[model samples]
Target: MLKNKGKRAYRVLDFLHEHVIAIIIAVVVLAGVISTIAIVKGDVKTSSEKENSIQYEEMSTIYFAMDPVKSLNPLSSQDRDVYYISQLMFSSLFKLNENLNIEPDLVSSYTANSGSGTVSIKLREDAKFSDGSRVTAEDVRYTVSQILRIGDESPYYEYASKIDSVKTSGSYSLTITFENPNDAALDNLVFPIVSSSSYDDSANKIVGSGQYAYDSYDSMKLLKLKPNTYYYGGVPQNRIQFKIIQDKTKTTGLMTTDAITAYVSTAQDADSDAEDKKLKVTKIPSSELEYLGFNFDNKYLAKKEVRQAIALAIDTESLIQDNYGGAGITSDSVYFPGFLGTENKGDFYKQDQKGASELLQKSGFKDSNEDGILEDSKGRDFQLTILVNSNDGSRSDTASSISEALNQIGIKASVKKVSWAEYRSEVRSGDFDLFLGGYQFDKKYDLRSLFSKSNYLGYKNDQILASVKKLETCISAEQQKETYEKLKTMLQEELPYYSLCYKTYSFITVKEFTSTETPTFFDMYRGCDTWKWKKVVVTEQKDDE
Candidate 1:
């Protein structure tokens, strides 16, 4: 009977196709037939009700939120969302772990010689691409070549620029030479490696050996992903989906509305908002260092005593609480606390009103007229103006607080807020006394580039730069850490720049997970490779009379 029904249905469809075009349309419309998704953006209702239908794995699945993708090519595009989704589909030789330490990913191990500026890497024999092909040393060479080909536009350019040459010893052994001795050679090799044989430069196709593989993509809606069967790492989530979000500000709304299950955000109120919605939010510390930049050329402002006094007057603890909502780590040193097995001596540079006054008096500055303002021995009036970008609410508030603190300490100060363009112009032109600045250091924490930039502030300190060079040549990690300690001490003593606090970001999710590793700023999806999921349990309760 079933076979007869199938034959009759086939015949009816064939007759309809040969007899009338309008009847065929009616049949398709009635049957809810869906066509293959095309590359287009609109609100057209797909017959399946969703664009690019997903094929789920036999295990668990997770939906993640990302901004609209302009291109799937992670190397060529400037989209952070694209970079993030690509991490799920691609594997790299080295990756930043939960503690922001560089560890081997696809490679078995590596040997570096700082004296020779060379590094030798051995790939994992079991490593394979999504196509089940062995990852060769040639592929590593090709990946670095592509990054260098993109010039400075590629985010990996800075890391790749130090690589003077790449030479493959065999199918799985490769050697990299740097322009000069670099202690961060291992950290610089954290870029993703692609299969040259499977990927085409002209096309935006991605072929990687990560935990997930490309399943399907609907132009303006969402991209579906399936598990990579050849993946060596354990697949925590069997399937994954990335919903296209054109506006990032709508992430919290979509999460509450069930449009997406999880997302990562740096917004100040992200944690609070998640609490209101009863969603799980993980607070993670980011590496973006927030600090105060000073113009050292001004004679009166160039005194170390004056800078130290100002630093003491500004309450860093209060700034972190008021401006950051207590979502930051306060520090007098620029380095992240406890990094590289380093120790911090308590009260090294905490706020002290008496200490601040003593420093000002030591600098030969005093309130000669007793009018709540300071003047030099020569009766020279002193004042400072802090420049901040108007778009950043937190930094703007910080500037205002610093201004008020200085006023209370008998030092005249004010804040100047401007658009991003004008802020940069004023700093570069040396038209400002002080400015609020932030730097998102690379995984390597390359301080050389930061110190070697053109003399925009006309700030000179040969001793500090020398210390950094020494830090680069240290052969052992222990020696490097010791050298960095010396460098941090010099920075504090010289007061070339002021170190403020490090901020934190939040990762909010609506789904229940059995287990998950902490994520870091270097890789927000650090847990995807090992995360375990659990089905949401629903309970029903009854009220009896």
Candidate 2:
């Protein structure tokens, strides 16, 4: 009876064990199905979040055949573009706003003590560099010292000649004392500040107090900048990519292809082509002045009447309307329109071909050969060589137009096209007679440097120098203006160079990016750290969908 009962119990236990195994298998299968669904749902949710939260990345680049001199140091290159690019990587004590008015960037405000040749600057306490370091008055003093010490042959040295000492009085205050007070003394203080620690000899590495810092730069290839995480102000877009496309035509092509977002203009009319379809163009008053500068030592240019005749003969208005697309303004004097003390009364200059011809005849140039060409009394043809940089479109065009105009007046004018380097060398050595060049006027409206004894042209005028000195020392703005006006009238009479026109520059940019303020001669890239990108429609994604 016991064996039979045990057998029944064992049979029941065996049956239950078999059913439990089947149930366990079913539960495992069900769990696997549920886990698969959860994973699929999580993946879908992650993809949606990525699409919604990610910032759209875009890049804007400028093309130039020449690579920027590896340093963002202000004293590195004299080229305006080099300075421009460096401004993006460096911060200045003072910056100019759209109206060509002085606006403080790193500095909140500054006062000039004309009598002591001293300048006191107040900095914004909240100003911090691209690095996490705070920018202090000590940085300003150090920058001034570095510029004066290391920048011997630099343009900065020439501008900062008056500065004898620089020191910090407080955490946010800086004092600069000049040995001699010059009118352009305060203006010369505008320079980029760099940390002594970050400055290294590495070719493309940049550590700056700017809106952007170097992400990567391969010589003559591409330069990439990423927004500084520690920036104190508005940050630029995620990245800025600079591609090296030297050919202007190719640059425009890249714009059409959507490979580049913008192109800043070196030409007056950069928007006059096919790329306009994708870009909006804005014109800014340029500080650039296109002129015909005679090597002062040139025998032919030494004659006052000869210089006057050439100035009179050039038809500025026709050249402005034709080559400049009616975008240029006639310059009556050396000072451009926006200078502190410049007074331009339009009638001071007249485009009188008849008057020019009379002056030429009086200067001993006559149509002796009946070939419609003038020759001097000594049979020296009234011919002049006008040199221009081949890369400069505006200057080259103006040179050609002037040649034509001179031909009309029986004066033989020849346009000599040369590389910019060669032209600069020739102009500096005083080897050429008349060269087509441009002077970029700075914020102070100082022309003394241009006409100084040791300037590029080596043109010396004591009267002009004295006037510039007075303008620098004058405490009152009105007094400074009066002094500058006096100097302009005097320089205009001398005709050191034929001031053709003050050019206006136009640029086409993507509307999503903010532009520098008006009369944009001052550094446009100053507040780049503070520039924010507006929303852009990424055409890569379908809007309708």
> What tens digits encode model 1's per-residue C-alpha lDDT throughout 361-425?
88898988988898888987668899999999999999999999888888889999999999989
The superposed Cα distance between candidate 1 and the true structure at residue 52, in angstroms, equals: 34
Worst 10 contiguous positions by lDDT, candidate 1: 50-59
**Candidate 1 clash total?**
0
Model 1, runs deviating above 4 Å: 1-59, 180-184, 235-238, 257-259, 325-327, 336-338, 341-348, 470-479, 511-516, 532-545
TM-score of 2: 0.62
On TM-score, the candidate that comes out on top is 1
Clash pairs, model 2 backbone: 98-517, 98-518, 183-472, 211-529
Native-referenced Cα lDDT, model 1: 0.76
lDDT of 1 at 335: 65
Question: What are the clash counts of all predictions, listed in order?
Answer: 0, 4
